[model samples]
Target: MGVTLLTGASTGIGRSLARRLAARGEAMALVARRGELLDSLVIEIEQAGGQALALPCDVTDRDALARALASAEAELGPVTRLVANAGGGEPTFVDGFDSAAFEAVIQLNLIGVANSVAAVLPGMLARGDGHLVATGSLAGRRGLPSAAAYSAAKGGLANLMDSLRIDLRGRGVAVTLLMPGFVRKHEPKPGRGKTGRRRSKPFRVDLEYATARMEKAILARRRQLVFPLSLAVAIGLTRLLPFGLDARLLAGRGRRRPAAAQPPRTRL
Candidate 1:
């Protein structure tokens, strides 16, 4: 198998996908901001007889990401597959409207993907064979009340991937978009508080299952993949409802109080 470069490989869905690819004996370069986590994951993969390189860099920094990609190519051979998956989002508060925070989210979630693509596209185009995959979200399908920034970022990402798919067609580079909903990192422990309970997200799927489905899509070169059929159906149904009624329904659903502002965790 050709070497695959995966961003956000330190945690959550990125980690899961790396593990799955490693198990299949695909050589990989794991990229993330957390050097320690990348090192640990590299160790685990190597111990299991997989070839992997730990590349610690922020995807938001184009120069740093480009350097990391060069290092991976030197060690593992040219990266024939690129997973542009590093992203996170803070809730956008209409009351406060922090433009800085909104801009940061867009930079990380959308521009970060663009950076990853820039790092690999030249090499892929030269070779005339490669795959580019990105993680989008079902939330991108429509705007959510409290998650305006996040929804916008994801929606923009989905469109970006779609445009790439069209442009790259017949160019020997395939683009795939993974649209997942509510992937739970871990199950919440019992007996926290109402606040903790409210923090818990719904329609969650375990990492293993999500990874498996993602792998299948990547291997099949699917143009778009949306998981957890139930959530997809629900989101689809909402589109058919009357605009006023749908708006009211969304309004009736309570939103969690905004937490203190902080950078979103660098994970998908």
Candidate 2:
């Protein structure tokens, strides 16, 4: 296996996936904005007899991202697989529409992937072998209550990956899009949402569960993968409903405004 380069490797899903890939003896280049965290992770992997190079990067910056990719190739090896897993979004509400905030989300979730693809695809095309993996979300399937910005960003990413998958077919570069739902830091607990009502995450899974399935799909080069099955099925059913009805059904769900800013983590 050639070097696998992953962004957002400091925490959450990216960190989990990095650990799993390392355990499987894959030499990797870990990228994240937090250099200290990346260094610590590198040390841990090295102690475990796994090879890893920590390359601090912010995926939103195209030039910086390109430099990081080049460093990965120089230090680890040619990156045969690129996981564009760096993204985060804040809730966007109709009552308080912030274009700057919305653009930030789009930049991270959509343009960030584009930057990563631009940086890596040329080499993959030249070599005729590479895998491009992106972490999307079930929220991308449709517009959510207060996640207008996030939903739009993820939706755009889904289409971008789909288009790339179609265009790159038979070209030796594989594109895999992973759509996961409700990956929480811990077990679900009942809590009051923005509407001041108790809410629960349906069919939520932990980081470990999400990482295992994602790793399998990435390794197998699956075209598109959605999990967990229960949530995917439920979201699939929602797609068939009339837009008006679907909107009504989910209006009360996910209406809570997140903190002022959220760090790059798994899509919620």
Candidate 3:
């Protein structure tokens, strides 16, 4: 079987997807900035009777990514699937401006993804057998106030996947845009854990459920997969709302809850 290379393989959805794919007997090349984490994941998968090659390379470094791909091919095989999953950005408002943070966000969230795509796609096209899967967000469908950079990057990613699908349609390579909404990775929701681990509160859509949906879509080469029927509906409504109202409605969801209002205490 050809290798499946996944970026951001250290944690969250990327890690989960890697585990699932490996369990299904898919050989994998795991990529992430965290060397130790990638090593651990590879060991776990191998111990479970799977094959994996851990590659610790910063996606933002284009040459590093290319080298990593070469390494994977040498060890595992040609990558038949590319998962562009790593991304991060600092939340910024127009008032509290930080140019450095803004640029860093754009570089990591946008250029990093593009670099990964460039690295593996040529080989896939030449072989005429591979798939490109990317993670996009509901925020990409509309502008979210404090998350301008985040939305912009994901939106670009979704569009890029679409264009790539068209550009390589005849080559037998396909692209899948995995669009998700509000994934709560920091905390687990109640009832999510079987071993009594603290589960995060359920966000717009549960990650596990969404990942399964994504897997089927990828296998079928679906152009796009957006989750949470209601959320998609809400986004549809956004297009119809007047700017003043829509933006305001979208603004409140991302607001930081003020630190618990402290009561004034008087000591006797």
RMSD (Å) per prediction? 2.3, 2.9, 6.8
TM-score per candidate, in order? 0.93, 0.91, 0.87
The better candidate by lDDT, 2 or 3, is 2
What stretches of model 1 exceed 4 Å from their correct place?
A: 192-196, 252-255, 259-268
Q: Quote model 3's TM-score.
A: 0.87
After TM-score superposition, the amount by which residue 137's alpha carbon in candidate 3 deviates from its true location, in angstroms, is 0.9
- Clash-forming residue pairs, model 2: none
Screening candidate 1 with a backbone cut-off below 3 angstroms (N, C-alpha, C), the clashing residue pairs are none
Per-residue CA lDDT of model 1 for 225-245, tens digit only, reads 997888888877777898577
lDDT per model vs. reference: 0.86, 0.86, 0.78
lDDT by residue (tens digit), candidate 2, 115-178: 9999999999999999999999998988777788898999999999999989999999999999
Candidate 3 segments whose C-alpha is farther than 4 A from its true place: 186-203, 257-268
Q: Least accurate stretch of 10 residues (summed lDDT) in model 2?
A: 187-196
Tens digit of lDDT per residue, candidate 3, span 99-148?
A: 77667766776788889889998998888888888888777887776677
Task: Count clashing pairs, candidate 1.
Answer: 0
lDDT of 3: 0.78
For candidate 2, the per-residue lDDT at 105 reads: 92
